[model samples]
Target: MLEIITSSALPVRHGFFTRKGGASSGVFAGLNCGTGSSDQTEIVAINRARVAEAMGVDAGALAAVHQVHSADVVTVVGPTADRPRADALVTAAPGVALSVLTADCQPVLLADPQARVIGAAHAGWRGALDGVLEATLDAMEAAGARRDRIRAVIGPSISQPAYEVGQEFFDAFLAEDRDNHRFFTHSPAGRYLFDLPSYGLHRLRSAGVGHAEWTGHCTYRDSERFFSYRRTTHAGEADYGRLISAIRL
Candidate 1:
């Protein structure tokens, strides 16, 4: 069985899928839905098909982007073969599930059930700093969703304890806003430990979302349930699986 995390805040049918009960093997084991990975194409397709079935949509109805870690958000109306170079996707069309893939990055799912609009975003630190969450909200609004009525839930990601950063990384966030310093702490390694989920929540709240939350699951800490790029690198692995999170109206 698949282990899918959900938030009651979102009234739409959605889930934050973990790396479990998949057809993948080796380094890309367990629900590795990333098409960009070196995993067997057929296995990845099977995993994605399972997710689509869980979402009550056909495999072709699962819409996703190429995910360039940018602030770009695509307004999807129907399923397409083309995966655009974007980080987020929003849709008001029913039966079309908006999805995003992540290994350690944030997979944010947003919805305004009253308006029947939903969105999914891939937000790593770079993408979050670039305003991907805000961009998704803007796209949802354009699709007839209200920010005041929207509920945003950030799925499993690298938490502060496992997300050590360099001085340059801290400087980039500080360059954006000195207040961003609050999201970091001095690490025992003399570096910084950045709080990605907290920053995500801050951004969502600042954008006037009615509700925002993180599922409090850390990908790096739970190797059995999640795939972490940083952990894979630390373990000297070639590649890691990607967790898929989706939302549908």
Candidate 2:
């Protein structure tokens, strides 16, 4: 069975799918839906199709993007002819499921049910710091959603404890804004641990969104349930799987 996480704030047909019930094997076992991974293309398609079925949509109706880790957002009208090179997707039309693939990055789902608009985003540190979450809201508003009426939930991602960074990473965030210091804490190893989800929520709240929250799932820590790029790298694994999150109007 598939274990999907749903948020009360988003009263729509949506889910943050865990790495459960899939066809891939070995390190890519359990719902590895990333088409970009080295995992067999056919297997990735099968996993994505499973996710579509769970979301009550045709396999073709599940729309996603190339995810270049930019702040770009695309507005979807129907089944995509081509997945655009972007990090986020928004739609007002029903039946079109918006999705984002991530390993340790945040798979953010946003909705304004009152306006029938929904958005899904892939927020890695670069994309989040570059304004992908706020850009998602901007696109939703353009699609007739109200900022104050929107609710966004960030799904499984690396937590601070598992995310160790060098001085340059810390300096980069501090350069962006000094207040970013609060999101970082020194570790016993003398490195900084970055709180990715907390930083994501801070951006969402600062953008004036009505509600936002992290699901409190640490992908790096929970190896059995979620995929983690960092964990994969740490283990010297060849490749990693990407978790899928979706929201449909």
Q: Tell me the TM-score of each prediction against the true structure.
A: 0.99, 0.99
Cα-based lDDT for every prediction: 0.94, 0.94
What would the per-residue lDDT of candidate 2 be over residues 143-223, giving only the tens digit for each residue?
Answer: 999999999999999999999999999999999999999999989988999999999999999999999998999999999
TM-score of 2: 0.99
Instruction: List the lowest-lDDT window of 10 residues for candidate 2.
Output: 75-84
RMSD of each: 0.7, 0.7
Steric collisions counted per model:
0, 0
Model 2: residues with Cα > 4 Å off, grouped in runs: none
**lDDT of candidate model 1 versus the reference:** 0.94
Query: Model 1 off-target regions past 4 Å?
Result: none
Candidate 1 accuracy as TM-score: 0.99
